[model samples]
Target: MHETDVAIIGAGPVGLFAVFECGMLKMRCTVIDALDAIGGQCTALYPEKPIYDIPAHPAIAGGDLIAALDRQIAPFAPRLLLGQRVERMTDLGDGWIVIATSAGETVRAKAVIIAAGAGAFGPNRPPLPGIEAFEATSGVRYFVNKREDFRGKSVVIAGGGDSAVDWALSLKDIAAKVMFVHRRPKFRAAPETVAQLEAAAERGEVEMVVPYQLHGLAGDDGVLRAVEVATLKGEIRTLPADHLLAFFGLSMELGPIAEWGLGLTHNHVTVTPATCETNIPGVFAIGDIATYPGKLKLILQGFSEAAMAAHAIHPRVFPGEALHFEYSTSKGVKTA
Candidate 1:
């Protein structure tokens, strides 16, 4: 068993930032995550993908961004409970909470903050026969971890969303051949990006095969050699390919957190915008797993949510202590 001022669920960017915000307010935190390491989806999904929206950074890879966040919160030295999923949370009526983990560990804290990003998330795999076999052999990859690995290779990208369109453009110059297959002629990407894809197709850089669906894959021992596609009318065609990249978006589930009884709106925890507090007292939700009216799902917004939640939790951790709001310059971080 461990005790702290706050027990934060999810060790993603927002969760890590919460440690700093709470630390700056003189609150100690215990961070819990299901993954063995921090960074959550960024580390698990696309670590090498460059994120352009992070403030003060023109461009930063997902892994590097998490590394910077880890450094920023180093002085706090928050306890990290990794490789365990939060199974249950019990609010101790007296403004305190007890948390239970899948690893059979317990955590008692004054408050709880949930930063679970879309809960447990993963790329939605397409319904294809023997797809799992190829998936295990790297013949089919849903994530683009390292772009250099696809260089000088033939890739068959399927889907009409931003990922399929973006990756096609990203690997067009690197891959020996880029074959894009989609069931619809229209792409669900930014218009400018779609225009760029069209231009690339015109220049013979990308081959656009529209109104088709993946029919079968030809390979030996889980190694891809060609991709077969068929039109709605049953016209089939085989395209040479070394790999298949399927961008079917991601599927999100609340997992065991669903039974926590917090107000849920479309798998997201309902929170008051002012303090990021959920219906349960001493329990708050932040980041993508939290939702309110007119909420913009962005990391910057999550950072703001973290600050609000920390400030709201400050009073609970230190009862009867007045919180005089002050900037970091006034009271620098006190290291452990």
Candidate 2:
């Protein structure tokens, strides 16, 4: 069994940052993730997707952000067990917790941090006949891994949410012809982004197919030719396309955390706002998996929660030691 001061049950951005925070406080951590690699959904889902809200860098891809976080926590030398889903947590009752994983590895820790973000983000696949066939050939894609792949191709973007609208705008200049098809006339994207998309449409840069839903996929022998969309009144229109990009929102699953018996609020772990601790002592939840009063579901907020959880857990890891709170600037990080 691996032993550490803290066992972090997610290796996403927030969890990686938590390693840095805990390391700063002299806490050793063993990080575990269900994914084969770190960075969570950011690394897996949309590595090429540009994130605009992250501080310092005005714009960074999801993959780049994870790379930077990984580097930031490198000095901590935290133990990482990838591709292993934590199955259960056992309270040793003597200030130590035992964590069991599906991989048969066991971890004993002074405290636990659940940093799994909003469970897992699985795309909601559109129910189109022969969709599975096209999907196998990359003719229909639910997630954008590489933007360049869609270049010079007639693309049909379907959905009303941010992912659909955002990708349409992002690929408008790259794709040979961009078609935006949504069931509703009004989009569910941010106002500013919607305005930009509309402005692009006005300039004839994008073809907007409104009040329509994905009807079927037109393809043969693993090759796609067009996307069929229809209105609520059964008006069918076929948009000639090389590839169909469906951006229906993702479905979230808490996975094993739901079975861990933590106080859950709509699949999110209920935690104390002050310390980011769950109903059980010595087990803290942070990032998107955690919920509290007035909590803003943002990466920056999750970073702050990581710090709070680390500080609250410091005492348990090192009993009788008073934590001298000091800013990073005052006492720069020292590699262990």
Candidate 3:
């Protein structure tokens, strides 16, 4: 078992930032994440994707942001408990809370903060026969972990979401032949990306097959021969391909956190925006997992919530202690 001032439930951008905030108030923190590494979904899902709304940076890659956050909190030296999902949390009266993880590790802290964004997420796979066979063999990929894998190969992409459009445009120059098949004429990606896909289609670099859904997949143990699609009119067509990429988005679950008996609204924890605290005293919620009136699910907003939660949590950890909040520039990070 370990002990800290705060036990953050997620190690994403918001949770990482909270470590910095808590550190400023001389509070030790332990960040727990189900993933083997930090950065949560940002690192696990789209590490190469670009984010435009982070403060001070016009645009930054997802992985870069996580790296920067890791650096910013390095001085704090918060303990990281990764690869373990929080299994249970118990209030130990007198303002102490004990949290246990799936790995059987336990941590006692004065406060708990839930910064899990969309909770545990997994890609929504397409409903096709033998899809799992290809999935296990790398013939079918739900995400573009490495763009070079599709180099000089015939690729068929399914879905009409941002991931589908983005990957289509991203791999257009690398793949020998790229085809995008969707069930609707319109795409759910950004307008600019949709325009780029259209321009690529017009240039004959990409084949656009609309009003079609994935019917089946033709492949062997680990080899993909082609992708079969069915039109709305019941017409079936096959596209020869070496790889099939499906971007049907993700499925999110709150998991064990939902059983904690916190006030929940639409699967999100309800918190008072002022304190960023939930119905359970000494337990706070921030980032996308926290919802209040006029809440905007943005990274910057979560940063502000993290600050508020840290300030509110300070009093609980050290009873009757005066909190004189100072800017980082005023009193730079203090190293132990």
lDDT of 2 by residue, 1-336 (tens): 979999999999899999999999989999999899999978888888877668898778889999999888888899999999899898889999999999999999999999999886788999988888898999999888899999899999988877788888889989999999988879887788899999999999999998899998887797999899999999999888999989887899988778877999998999999999999899999998899889887888999999999999999999999888898999897643
What is the TM-score of candidate 3? Answer: 0.91
| Highest-lDDT candidate | 1
Query: In model 2, which range of ten residues has the least summed lDDT?
Result: 327-336
- TM value for model 1: 0.93
Go through the candidates in order and give each one's C-alpha lDDT. Answer: 0.92, 0.91, 0.90
Clashing pairs in 2: none
Rank ordering of all candidates by lDDT, starting from the highest: 1, 2, 3
Tens digits of per-residue lDDT, candidate 3, 190-302, equal: 78889989999999989998889999889777688999999988999999999998888888899999999999998899999899999999999999999999999789999
TM-scores, all candidates, are 0.93, 0.96, 0.91
Model 2 stretches with alpha carbons more than 4 Å out: 334-336
Q: What residue runs in model 3 are displaced by over 4 Å at the alpha carbon?
A: 334-336
Best by TM-score: 2
- Candidate 3: lDDT of 277? 95
